[model samples]
Target: MIRSHSKLATALMGGLAAGLLLTACGGSAEPSSTTAASSAASTAAEVATSAAAEPITLRFIWWGNDTRNALTQQVIDLYKTTHPNITIETETADFATYWQKLSTQVAGGDAPDIIQMDEKYLAEYASQGALLDLESIGLDTSDWAEGTVDAGRFDGTLYAATFGVNAPVFLANTSVFEKAGVEIPDDTTWTWESFAEMAKQIQAAGGGEYYGVENLIGVDGASKIWLRQQGAQQFTSDGIGFTAADIQPWFEYWKQLMDEGGTAPATATIENQTTAVDQAFLGTNRVAIGFQWSNQVNAVQNASGQDILILRPPTQTGNAADGHLWYKSSMYLSAGAKTKYPEAVKEFIEFLINDPDCGAILGTERGVPTNLKVREAVAPQLDAANTKVIEFMDSIADELGTGGSVPLPGGGQSETIQRRATDAVLLGDLDPATAAEQFVTELKAEMGLS
Candidate 1:
């Protein structure tokens, strides 16, 4: 939500490399007279020199692509202007590789001073003592988004800080609706049955393309929605939420849709050539509806040259609890448990979330700005697409169900249940009921739950 007139530059990748080299030489090498006095009371600051000195250097690292890396550097530069004595070292990479490097650093006692973490890994990292307790570092969470902060906590102690919220939204091509002679329904009250039925209707009234919607069994997000509808969580406090019986009904639901020709064939999901943003089948007029996060609607619409409207997921109850999408931190910033300058690292995180310039430069790249103050500051500068997302989320704020607990402690295999559902069905190893039962058992076992 923080919108800055100045664009953020992505220089952290290079800066981080330099920081690592300096770290190799050891932080104790020599304190430049410029290094400020450490006023931070945390243990990490205990080793510093006189309080009259300038702020010391704090090394931070995170995973992100070109845009994210650039914006992060811009924010850091802005922070440096005000707190001139403090220096921040940053690193970045794509999501998958980012974790690999972070895990290694954690094991080697050289983890970055600050890390950009994800919910899927939050519990695991926090449990392993790889991260610092955020409260110990002087972070104030009184103003961050509720869900964002909650996502970063482990065992009731806040360990990280978050910056935004994301929700699943249905991207629709209004032009396709007109051509197919179909009317968009009041999504608030529409049920999954209604959505499936409507897709059939659109296919019957076909104009150009496969049908009214294209969803895939292989899509993890979609599977999450179905899992929620069945009154199960993705992962439980102990581990997997449901047994194989629970998975069966959901698999059968999708299988029925696929069998009825209401969605694109399985081959399409596996073989489609499309960029993450373009969504080729939906953008090129081959499908009318696509499931994506609200943050992605703009890119999808831009590629298609169509009027895109975000709609609520279809659910049975008018009460709406059955179809709510919980908000999450776009990413979290946590300190390495082994860092030599924990206070500096904590200060760097504080500046990133609370500084006006940092928030503005961040804009919506992290999803909606998690800071209430930042959201207000950046609202005026938002583009139409971004503004729409803000307004939509505000409208549904009260309607969202409980954000729920953080994901369980399974590392790489946390999402396995969703992935294996179809395979279990296709291989004839078990029926839907049996598959669901086995899924629950495996998930619990992986989570270390009895």
Candidate 2:
């Protein structure tokens, strides 16, 4: 699910103000440089200037908070220092509004030259010819890990470059565990049943002060992992891969957790599920365990003021080998298909992916570096939290399954549907079996399969 904040509201109001200002000014006013050059010598200079290298202005757009924006701007500045003829203008919005604005801009033929993309929408845009083929543009991927380059492919063409790689992880607040006098379960050998039992124990020990884990029934990431564990893809080349039967058990599992007091109450879980990272159950020390992307470890630690430990999600059959974990592109960078300056955009993407200096500056904020060389070079410089994430990822490398399927055109709506269905189940409006059935039906309709 996309997290929201007051920043998005501020950005929306700013956009409105800019629109009103443009209306007041009656659009952009032109300068009369040509009319001022009356002398032959001045005309000659003007002609020469027109023939010389013109400055290339590229507009780039992304979704992030102030920290990411600052680091990205630094990288852009570094690039500009070397390529003085190129100029870059950046626009940013919170995750909740980024896609809405991007879709509107693209439809109006005002898309940015460079776009920060997510896996959920990459295929949706690429399949519609909105994104450029990176391979065709000659963006280098030779330094990237093997098969990592394929994360952004659609119909055998590379539409984007993997900017960073991550995987879903269970983030345990060690302090909370210690306070409850509960030992962290061995992730390598833990099954879903054992996981629930552990959570129940933690909650029992906390005396209402804390919960064992955040209620994750509505979390799309958890659903994906569950599907993978069942040897099912979330999306296939054909359509949605899992059936109602596949989904029923997942809902049942979480319902069981709620019944056993292993997680927060239904209403509280629904509220916390959508809360911002800094104020969520895990972030506020209201829960001992929670789920998040691996890249979020540092941020969660910073917010909670506690030592956070990353663990592999529980598997079926109590075996790590049965886990269907895989490395995913945390996000991607794609050039606009309609960009006027494709070559310059491609150059900038190349620098972002392969430059050691850029890697140092970014330092896993986006994710672990996609470029293997950069990953190796920046290892010693990472802080303790990031280092733990890196180590966890490396330890699980051999256990991962194949990469996940690309999300389909309407795939973005699946999370919302999941949330609604899960809410109905938790509120006693629908049983697990009926909720699962309704979920599949709505998801099919959303993906145009119904």
Candidate 3:
């Protein structure tokens, strides 16, 4: 998915040693009238102090860059101030290595108390009995938008709580278009054909300085949209939902873009595959348009130093109704099923999801807040880039189609497989049809459907 608080010093414990010693030594002696009241009060105060709960330590882990890590630490510090009894230890890693580390941790029976989850792997972990059911732990989801609460649900149980909602978006660098003397296409009326044509024109106008668009054949997000627009899904409750025939056209479209010089060359696109967001073709100003999650607009804009515009991905029919766009959880907050501090983890999650302070600090780093109240509270404070993202999502709120299906077990492997197949086709190692067929076969086998 899109993928800091101050540290409070430990509070000094009240002195109870003297009070206990006095109680033990003063056995049969009654205090004088003048000292009786003071003595009793002191004794009671010490008893209360001794009875106070000790601090509970919680471990939270997530995948993100230094920016996200710093912001999250601030939130943790803020939470600690109010919840002095809870201490949270955080671990962070980049997206590429996160799952590998987490899997190792889980295998060693030492998963973090709080886990930052993605839709792709939520089911994988949940089904394996690694995640706690939020509902069972008393999480409040009443304020979340419709279907958002359910995004982290599997088999009718809530395993994770959505951190925020996002949708696939066309992040257009408007400055690039203007420089190329090309007009931005109207998203509402644009089709796949028009999209390609616009890309070709932009490339032509740029005099080879920039490609028209980033190559998206390897992106699972783009593939999902393509499948959804065909009235199918990448996965269903049963198995692979779309046939090889359905995916061939998607591959064919990218081939056409490459042939027309509308997208980066195979090698450039492959190189872009492993590039960071800040170093990608779009971020580095090598393309006029690129596809990304809605929440990533700010980062791309900051990286490119351009007037980034958020547009709906083009539909097959050039109509909003035909577009397969829908709101999805950018990520989720899940508690470990085996956590020793479930209540503490639950409270932390609740704060992260519903607290305005958390929302303000987090902003759209994850995505727009899933909590309606938090979303509204942070609206006025958003930067220009985030404001555009909010506006874009609002403009298409009613037009979104049904949300995507829950990815099945082993579904996390689909993206890598798709990327490999896309690379093969773009490199002429496989035709679109052959790549599509191989993709389906590999995906079905990975998901244990065959």
Q: Each candidate: what lDDT?
A: 0.69, 0.86, 0.84
Clashes (N, CA, C under 3 Å) per candidate: 20, 0, 6
Two-way TM-score contest, 1 vs 2, winner: 2
TM-score of each: 0.79, 0.87, 0.87
Writing each residue's lDDT as its tens digit, candidate 3 over 141-225 gives 8898888887888888899899988889998898889889988889999999999999988888888789899989989899889
lDDT of 1 by residue, 71-137 (tens): 7777766776566666666666656667887889888877778888887888889999988998887
lDDT of 2 at 151: 86
Worst ten in a row by lDDT for model 3: 1-10
State how far residue 24 of model 2 sits from its true place (Å).
35
For model 2, give the 10-residue run with minimal summed lDDT: 32-41
Judged by lDDT relative to the true structure, which candidate is superior, 1 or 3? 3
Ranking by lDDT: 2, 3, 1
Q: Which ranges of candidate 1 are over 4 A from the true structure?
A: 1-57, 203-211, 271-285, 302-305, 318-322, 423-430
- In Å, residue 436's CA in model 1 sits off its true spot by 2.4
